[model samples]
Target: MIPFLSAWPPSPANPTLPADELHVWVASLNRSQTQLNQFWQHLSEDERARANRFYFDHDREHYIVARGLLRQLLGNYLQLPAHLIAFAYGEHGKPELAAEQATSGVRFNISHAQGVALLAFSRNREVGVDIEQVRPLDDGEQIAERFFSENEVAVFTAVPPEQKPQAFFNCWTRKEAFIKVIGEGLSCPLDSFDVTLKPGEPADLLQVKGSREAAARWRLENLEPANGYAGAVIAEGREWQLRTWQWPA
Candidate 1:
């Protein structure tokens, strides 16, 4: 069975969530075949098909483990068995529950970079999360200038050379989280808004098309899921207390 780190059998009797809290679960996707097989037992047929579509064995294994973990968590949250959980996709391929489960008030978003995965959950509010492995990038600056907003580009340009790699991912992950929160995916223009990208700077949305109020409505928090990897979480409200945990190895 996939194991949670601790305290994860959330009390169903007291399922009412605090209005000001969010939970982020960080886990590694790399799993042994035996573990992978156990996870696969919880998957829906459609998910299995998608997993089978991956050409590489590792890619397929990762997909199964990721979806399996997702189902397991949702099951715990909803007090249901893992395979009983159902998912429906949004217009932009964002996954949601069937209309029957809409009243549960559990909002979540997922992102995986390389082998690390992040899952963000909240009650009655939109949430987004992203994780990315840090690696050498020859065209990091060029890509930033082309995609990041003007103000964001300025911030990226001002960062010292040695710190650019981390700063670039900082900006990229924040943008990705926001877009996922909005459920627009990449259909929304990356350059339409700005986000904090410099090292040592507080994580913030900065500005969304110069609307300070719009910017203020969102919150960004840096995530350190593992060394050599960067993560971020953005949501539609402010001052939401964050609680994060990792899956058992």
Candidate 2:
């Protein structure tokens, strides 16, 4: 039911949506040399350096493609050259455009797992997006017991055996996205909040400790980026509508 991004390679489409809408773009890093070069040319010098730091060539290329496309899309929205976009990191290492150079309260977050990446943008609200490849978990229950809130652990244990892998990632991505939205990274304990994980349940933030009312303030929307991966977006305000797209490589 999500609308994939209609834009293609070389040029990105400028997204125009209502004030309360959140736009999400997903892309695959499996690109040809030509596409890789296109993304690399748009990246800042620092981004290029970061790309080179990865130990594996595959990892290096993923970094380059992820960042290059990020800058390209941001530039399209801001009407600036992609390489010129400057970034500032939050206290917990979340990257954001430098306040002085950013306009219209434009904000974005990116997450890539395996070969897939998801990026989400919102005008004024804090936003976080995460994508994870659903894979086998050798000690799923043990991990859940250690990190999940008591109620979340209860829910996790209740799911039937066949659904554990998807359920585990569903919970993980939801928690990660919320932490990113709050700009707290690992500083915000994962067990402090609750998220829904059962297969048929809606993707949602169910509760928040200390800040008991926060669960209602943030909204979680489920995403299916590819066949075996799961993705989600968490935005501070519940009023926002979500539009998903498949960004061109």
What does candidate 1's lDDT look like per residue over 1-249, in tens digits? 233335432323323346688888877799888989989999999889999999999789888988898888777778888899888889999988777666788788888877778888887788989888777699987898799998888888888988888899999999999899989988889999888888878888988877878989888998877777778998878878987777766
TM-score of each predicted structure versus truth: 0.92, 0.92
Clashing pairs in 2: 5-245, 5-246
lDDT for each of the candidates?
0.83, 0.84
Can you give the lDDT of residue 195 in candidate 1? 87
Residue pairs of candidate 1 with colliding backbone atoms: none
Q: Can you tell me which runs of candidate 2 are displaced by over 4 Å?
A: 1-12, 210-212
Identify the leading candidate in terms of TM-score.
Answer: 2
Question: Alpha-carbon error at 156 in model 1, in Å?
Answer: 0.9
Over 76-179, each residue of candidate 2 has an lDDT whose tens digit, in order, gives 77778988889999888999889766665888999998888898988888899999988979998999998888988998898988999999999989998988
The reply for model 1, stretches above 4 Å from the true place, is 1-17
TM-score of 1: 0.92
lDDT of 1 at 104: 87
Local distance difference test, candidate 1: 0.83
